[model samples]
Target: MAYLRLFDWYQTNKRDLPFRKTDNPYHIWVSEIMLQQTQVDTMLPFYDRFLTIYPTIQDLARADIDEILKVVQGIGYYRRFRMLHKGAQYVIDHHDGKLPEDYFKILKIPGIGAYTAGAIMSIAFHKPYPATDGNVIRVLSRVKMLEDDFRLDKNKKKLNEMNKELIENSNNPYLYTQSMMELGATVCKVSNPLCDTCPLQEVCLANINNVQQNYPKMSPLKTKKEIQYFTFILEYKEGFLMRKRTEDLLHGFYEFVQIESDSLNGALTQAQDLGLEIQILDELQPIKHVFTHMIWQINLYRGTISNITSPYEIVHDFSQVPIATVVKKQIKQI
Candidate 1:
């Protein structure tokens, strides 16, 4: 009955997202991957541009990683793109370029997990599969009024099983899954839920008791690790020297000459190691960047490099390179 009500509400209330316009599995897969830990509004432009570049799975499988990352650069979370690329290649090689409809087979793909695999199966293939995301988890927890910490593995596993059963029993699995997600995102939000507008308000235990926030119990956030870096825009004749990061955190992304130094003297010492006598033309204001697990305090400096090197790549055109967002912000300060 709740499913029916949610579906009815979704018929007119669903957001007209571009990904919802088609039943193509490839498109849906791309959208699902992009949607992970990313806001819909922020990813829309990037999704459109990404599809324009690699409209087909085959096209994506063949595109260079650099080219793919260039398009996905500003969107952040480069690892997702890398995984998408690997998944596309896997699909092409094994599944004949078509996304497998079988849930197990789809799960075997490099980037896809339980949620993504379920979404593609139900939405694109019209199969009975449940895709439980964070929003869906919240909705289910409140509907059942489960007091268990939803962040715990046992509770999450239980919710996934519950969702699977719900999907299996539903007459319209496709609409059921989508509508549930829509309801959670728009109506049954985590904080200050729109209980009056929610279709499940009457049936939801959390809503009836006015304890929506207390249902989906969350774990405390961990302390953000602090790190300090000295970034330099080593400008040569007409370009800045850039290097590809092979280290952990933002691995494989490009950035200006940088070193992990908290002080100017220490940064200068590291700069000398690179065989460059840098005259500090400008010392920009310090910039702070917060990642999921860490906080970066960056000191930015800009100066023309006295020595040109073969180890560094010269980038004159910013548009042509796929630079990390943190590095771009530092460059903008110069």
Candidate 2:
């Protein structure tokens, strides 16, 4: 009864997303990868542009990694793009230019984890696999009145076992998996859930006990590490000086020279250490950029220099360059 009602609700209410128009594993894989830690609306433009650029797995495999990153630049989580490129190449080399249907084999691909592997297997291949994402976890936790810490491996294992049963018993595993995820995303949300409109409200243990907000229990959130950045957007002639990072974060992404210092004096000291004669034109409003675990308090400064004294790429046309999103915002302010 629960599965039947959920499917019926989904069929009538599901959003007509581009990815839902096909059962192709390749398209589904792209959507799932982009959906991670990103909102659907935020991903729509990137998804459409991405598919337009690389319409097929073979096309993706043949494309350059830098090109792929350029396409997905502002969307962030560049590592996912790297994995997508590598994984597509792997498929072309080993799987005949097609994504593997087997769950375990999908898991073997880099950046393709249990949830993503399960999602592709069930949604694209109609396999009886449970794609247990955070949405599924939330829905199931409320349905069963579970109170275990979600970060614990034992709890995740137990939840996966329960989802396995649900999928195995489902008459249409593909629809069932999508419907469950849809239900959680649209109705059974993390806060202020629409319990009255939820299909499983009648059987939901948390709803029955009037504790819907407390079922999916979790530990308190961690404090974000605070850091300061002094961004210097120095212009010489018609171009600005930009450089690619060799660090783990935002690797290969272009940005204006930034000094990691909290005070103006420190920033000036670092800028002088670069051995470049620069004149400070004016200061701009500070910008704040937040990451998953860190908060960047950015201090923006725009200036001019007579010549390029440092080894930095001179970018005259941004259309041809893939600038970091954080730096892009700063440029807009100038």
Candidate 3:
């Protein structure tokens, strides 16, 4: 692959991330899982805190799910943490509390997919495995001047195979993997790539053709569905009434009383049906929250509730509870 120059560039220019400083596979695995959706800067503090709390995978395995949820409250995508928790337990029971060294064995753990497994294998074990994250894909797609749409499964498989061969034959697997990722994130960006600063400037076909932006062509995305709802944070005796979510993606999280409605009166009617007796105080501003598949046009409100017929918890402090990020956004300032 002739990536020795790329390796040198990475050593000289890579960001000084905490995970990169450690050879611990568990630490690198945690970083990979967190970095799956979050940017490095936003995830740095949480990473440090999480490691402080759970110094070892064994510590995570013994921790409660509620505490784990609280630790990563604002991070979003809580399912990953749940899976990581389960993976820790799995490693304890099957791998003697040690992160598996083999790629396939690591993949057997929950929440670890191909990219994560590859990252752990190469970055931690220094094995020759292709870690084709989004950044890596973009960088390689441009370097090879690939015309195939990377969105398609077959095209992605080809890219993996190509990079797999490159890493297997590279001067150093760990450096090559991180170097490709660093180059994509810093040099060969999705927009306005820095060709002059790129180590692979001479070999990049996208650069040779002067159409770097046109190389990694992606398919159009499906439109996210949008919905409107009215949500209320009803104050009770010295506290606010909220409910713990027991279903779907937000399971094991807390949320305010929300009704899928367009009007305040209609929302109140829905609330009445659910055995909620409330006195309307005032209506605050509305908020809109977007998810991967749907958009929530939430009409936010605050009021006092005299009594509750259904099961609901009275929370004195919202911060003390592991509320969903959407609910946290609408927390009533006391």
lDDT of 3 by residue, 57-118 (tens): 99999999999999988887889999999999999999999997898999899999988998
Per-residue alpha-carbon lDDT of model 1 for 20-119, expressed as tens digits? 9988899999999999988889999999999999999999999999888889987888898899999999999999999988999999999899899999
lDDT of each: 0.88, 0.88, 0.87
| Model 2: how far residue 283 lies from native, Å | 0.6
Can you tell me which runs of candidate 2 are displaced by over 4 Å?
A: 309-311
Each prediction's TM-score against the native?
Answer: 0.97, 0.96, 0.97
Q: After superposition, how far is residue 141 of candidate 1 from its true place, in Å?
A: 0.8
For candidate 3, give the lDDT: 0.87
Error of 3 at 227 (Å): 1.3
70: Cα error in model 2, Å: 1.8
Candidate 1's TM-score: 0.97
- State how far residue 128 of model 2 sits from its true place (Å): 0.7
Collision count of model 2: 0
